[model samples]
Target: MRFLDPTKIAEVAAKFMELSSPCRLCPRKCMVDRISGQIGYCGAGSLPSHSGILQHFGEEPPLVGIGGAGTIFFTHCNMQCVYCQNFQISRGECGEFVTVEELANEMLKLQLFGASNIEPVSPAHQMHLFLEALSIAARKGLDLPVVYNSSGYDSLEALKLLRGIVHVYLPDLKYADSRMSAKYSDCEDYVEVARPAIREMYDQVGDLELDSNGRAVRGLIIRHLMLPNDISGTVETMYWIRDNLSSTVAISLMAQYSPIYEAWKFPELNRRVRASEYNKVVDLCWDIGLENVFVQELESQDLCIPDFRNEKPFSWD
Candidate 1:
């Protein structure tokens, strides 16, 4: 990785640190001076705020073979989806701040624990922290690949810095319709923002590449969570991926949307995606000629969500 170059790492860290001061890390662009102790719309500050770090087996198959993906659940997010499974952390209601050095330590810890790759969950809002920690981690012999898992609402300027640093780009294409995004995630520009952002991510890392054992060594994984009543615009999203990126780009079609957090308030989002809804999207993906698509069963809502009230936040069986 270019980020491992001794000189490049320092320059990359310095480049992103400037963004945190004014906090232009995400598309929200609240422009609060996180360096001067102001909080931005993303809920992260100059320091890194993380909820938990562990080996996550719930990721896509390539990211989770025998060794799980090393997942560092970051504290806040740029978007506020009412049906978010991990709303407690995404809304900035949980987690604690860690120094950049400690962040490096955590990465190394996950590596020692036999994680296949390091995944920074909801990292769009805290790119500076991730880069800084990665610089230190690289110096300390952290050799695992990096996975940039995000909500898909990223700033192009921010994504430019991630070219050689990120090996696996896993982003959620939540909605193709801006109005639906506005209603659910409060991101009216989600389609406008995500389309280009995903294109950039794919440009950085092409279609998913796997090792001899089928573990992801590099490339992009597009995750589209199917919402009830066709609100997620899965058909439109699949078409966009096929046209904009490539048909071979890996897609994780999720049927695990559970009505959690504040989703009970929204009548349209108050239940799991129906079997018909999930199958329809999968069929359309095939029709779109997408080749590398992974699917979850229609009844995947039974998976347990780790309660942040305790030490563990989520688990997969």
Candidate 2:
């Protein structure tokens, strides 16, 4: 389950930096000239901006045990989900832009704080910068696992660039139906884009594989959040994962949907997911014979929504 060798990682980083003009990194394909600092749909220029980095304990059990997952919260996102939990960061409410060198240093700092791995959340837009930072960290001897945490709306080409580089591919399969995707995340081609992207991820790295110590070494972890009702399109998506991908892949069925962002405007997503909805999705997971499934406590809905201003990201000392 080892990822790409360090040399291969640097090579990928070098190629990624060459992309300096209008970028089409994500499915949105805004094609804005990010190299020259013009903002695109993601609201990020060529550089990487961070809301914060901390050890997050509020993740799935495998990611966060007695310690925590080293989580870097990136500002802005490719998909502007109506029920986004991290609205403060995703909506660009605040962040600090740092150089690639600074980003490398941040990785080391997280390790110093006893973080399990460097988890880059919402990193789809900053792949180039992240690659640069990764190369730097690799040189400086940052040895922890690197988690590519993202929304599934990524380009297959861009994702291929990450082959062998990313250890754990943590991506959300948000919508099973295209219409629901367009209504909530403003991406009509979400299912189309995410499906192939996930297949590529699976091709690169199969199901979850762990080290001798039980920490993940390399693999794909699919996360699906059940929306307030049946609005999340979970049933079809679950079946898709079961049928298309191997049943061995670790699937995290999340019930931590606390309405944020512009969710109030949409009646179906205005409130927390109902118990019936969560149970239904769980039942579907079992029906599909998905054994490597992770489920959150329904009460976790209240805690998963971070108090972005004060709480910082999850970490353990």
Candidate 3:
């Protein structure tokens, strides 16, 4: 469990803060001065805007241990995925802005409430704010492992700033083809950006490492959501992971793709992932000899989809 050195907090915070103004945090590079209240492609400013922070059990098994992952759902996203489950937050329609100190307090609260780890969802755009808050939290006895949960469109420059700061890297390798990504997520270069970003993450943390209690303390966990009509390119993604990265790299194969939000606009994406589709991806993983993989049930859509309007967004069985 390598934690950020408390002394290097200010130096790190400064490096990320510099990137925020020009807004080069993510690969989008919408160079609007966020520090001066200018909004960019992600629709984020200097302050961190978030929907909620709670013990979310709807994650991977290691992430959702007995205590559950302390997930801080940040508002806005670099890419506007058509079938986003948390459309309310990702579209920047709803959320409350919080200062660095307040965010730090929330991290401490999650730790006090017995969370396995501090997981920040969609954190690429708000890396500056998170690092500042995390530094404050670390100074105030917050010792939990930090999970850099992202959409995998992160810039290498921003990821370099998080080398020592982040313990667990949970990123989504959403697409293997650019055409699918451009049509669905509005990111033409998602595969190009995500590949190296994931590689950097794996280089930083290596394979997934679990603690004595089976909770993830450090490592990289790549999430691949199987989409309808093979839009997600599961076979290409699986082979790429095996050939490029190690076969031992952890993978969370999601079968919970529901046609929510703007997915209705696209006929091809307006349905759930079929059992056959899910099975094929799972079988492909085995065929490729990818060792560390976590699979979800095909009927997990209802449990996986979250409603941010409610106080408790997810339903636990």
Candidate 4:
């Protein structure tokens, strides 16, 4: 298996700390002076802000085997999803700032705990910092897959830099329509940015590849959390995937959307997804020639979104 270059990854990490003025690392292009510790829309400075770090089983089956994905919940996010389950941390409501050296320590700590992979949640705004920590871990004999868990609103240029660095790209194509994306996440150009960014991710890692033991060694895993009553324009999203991306890409059609964060404020997402809504989208994925699919049990909703706390980041401890 091909391993990421430890030296190159370390350079990318150190390069982020050298920024003087506003950093435009993410697609938001927020010109915030992160180097001098000025906060931006992401509520983060040059260094990374982590809420928790530990093994998590709330991920997909391949990611959450006996050895769970080593998940480090990065605080703050580029996009503000209306129904975010982890809004507390994503909105900077909770977390402690950690320098690049401290961040490196956290990565190594997870490795010592027998984690299958180092998973960074909501890392779009802190890609540079993540690369630095990854480099340190790589040099320290951390030889597990590095999973880049994101919300899919990434810059194509930034994604290009992550080529060969990220083993599995697990991103949520949240919206197919720009209006819905704007209304929910305040990003009208979500589809525009996400489409090309995902393409680049697929270009780097074509299809989801599993080992003989079924652990994901490499590739892209597209997650489309079927929103309440299929109101997120999932049908169009599936069609776009079939036409744009290769049919071999594995898709996790999730139905564990529980009302959390400020979901009750929006009538469309006030409740859980009905059975018919889940089936409709699942059927569409199959009809459109999407062969590789992973469906979450409807009962998995209660087990998916755990109470956001500072102690643990995932549903499964």
Residues 1-317, candidate 2: write the lDDT tens digits: 33335577788877766553567777777777887898888898767898888878777766764457888898999887887888889988878899989998998888788887878999888888887887788777787878889999988878888876787889999888888988898888998999899999999888888766667777899998888667778888788888898778899999988877789898877888888878877887887798889988898876676756765543222
TM-score of 2: 0.94
10 residues in a row with least lDDT, candidate 1: 1-10
For model 1 the local lDDT of residue 107 reads 90
Q: Model 4 scores what on Cα lDDT?
A: 0.82
lDDT of each: 0.85, 0.82, 0.89, 0.82
The residue-level lDDT of candidate 1 at 171 comes to: 94
- By TM-score, how accurate is candidate 3? 0.97
Q: Judge candidate 1 at residue 202 and give its lDDT.
A: 93
lDDT of 4 by residue, 225-295 (tens): 87885667788888888888977888889888888888889998899998888887788778888898899
- Candidate 2, residue 114: the lDDT equals 82
Instruction: Identify the candidate with maximal TM-score.
Output: 3
**What stretches of model 1 exceed 4 Å from their correct place?**
1-3
Q: Candidate 1 lDDT, tens digit per residue, 1-317?
A: 33255456667778888987777888888888988779877767778898888888877889985689899999888998988888888887878989999999999998888898889999887878788898888888888778889999999998898788788999999998999999889898999999899999999889888888788879999988888888898888888888878899999998888889999998988988888878877888887789989988765678746666567666443
Candidate 3 vs candidate 4: the lDDT winner is 3
Q: Residue-wise lDDT of candidate 3 within 155-177, one digit each (tens)? A: 99989878878889999999999
